[model samples]
Target: MALVRVQNFAVSLDGFGTGEGQSADAHFGHAGDRLHEWMFTTRWWQPGGSGGVDDAFVRQHDVGIGAEIMGAGKFGHPGWHEDPDWRGAWGPNPPFHTPVFVLTHHRREPIEMAGGTTFHFLDASPAEAVDVAREAAGGKDIRVGGGATTIREFLSAGLVDHLHVVVVPILLGRGVRLWDGLEGVERDFQVESTSSPSGVTHVTFTRTTA
Candidate 1:
């Protein structure tokens, strides 16, 4: 069974995933960069290195992700416009080699990257995007690599099967919250595991059967 998972989704102590007034320069909000300091230092994140925690928690959470789905904001672009010449922020060969489904209001043709990576823009709803992403993922899991809003969309729809959250010790008084507008949505989840390294708390939650 292919599961929909959100990995390393950072959040502040005050529950803000990103600060207000988002822009190309101020991604994740003004002080949102502080939330993801842990991931950037991980050995798995290195360009060409493999030396970090050897726990199954880290390995499963960090690597072997087959495909990714994200909102338009995660691409760090201006609106729902796509230019064939517009390469993503990561450049020619991005980190992700599998297909990436980007949720957007406007539609664009599929973009094939240097590696096996392909960016597919879809105008359909979140559920529709998941269907497309599942096929692209083959037998592997589909990951929701979000910028807050995207995660919330999938969670609200009860489509996420697993969530890995890295709760950073920071407080953004007012910003985009990870759980914002998710008050009424109902789903049962269990804390699968927790790990602490370098003062960062990584928590994994698995959706419980109803």
Candidate 2:
């Protein structure tokens, strides 16, 4: 079976995965690009970018990933369902080069983009969505590209096999936290953390009990 993974997910030290006041204008809400600053500095994001530890970790986000399942928040801003023309945040050629299943209440027709990326909307639970993505993955790994709530739901459902969380030093006192209801979730996985020079900690949870 293909493994289910969450890669390059960044959160603040206070555990907020994203800040409040999310809108079409602000994707990460009040947090802005703070959570992803380390990623943006990596060579994986652009030419001549840092080729150090941060780059190494960011590079793995798409490795062996055949399909991606993302929440509506990650797909678009809030109330994006109302905008029929909203394809996604990513431009014409999305980075995802495989079938991308978007979890949303307002299901829409599959939109094939310039690249191999095709958006398929589904109103399904984490397990159901994973099952659908796994089939489309063709035996490759499936990536759970997320918003805080989406990752939490998958974590609560025990559907994730590997989790890569980048803990940024900043603290967002009140926002969408990643570890809200996930108490003692470390027990299921052999947790490991590697601190980068950029002051961000890369923590990985590889399922040990699975």
Candidate 2: lDDT of 101? 94
Question: lDDT per model, in order?
Answer: 0.76, 0.93
Q: What is the C-alpha lDDT profile of model 2 across 1-210, one tens digit per residue?
A: 689999999999999999998888888889999999998888888889899999999989889999999999899988999998998988999999999999999999999998899999999999999999999999999999998899999999999999999999998887898998888888999999999999999999999885
What shift in Å separates residue 21 of candidate 2 from its native position after superposition? Answer: 1.1
* Candidate 2, poorest ten consecutive residues by summed lDDT: 39-48
User: Over 4 Å off in model 1, which ranges?
Assistant: 46-64, 80-84, 184-187, 192-195
Best by lDDT: 2
Model 1, position 168: C-alpha lDDT score: 79
Error (Å) of candidate 1 at residue 133 is 1.0
In model 1, the Cα lDDT at residue 139 comes to 75
**Worst window of 10 by summed lDDT in candidate 1:** 49-58
TM-score of each: 0.85, 0.97
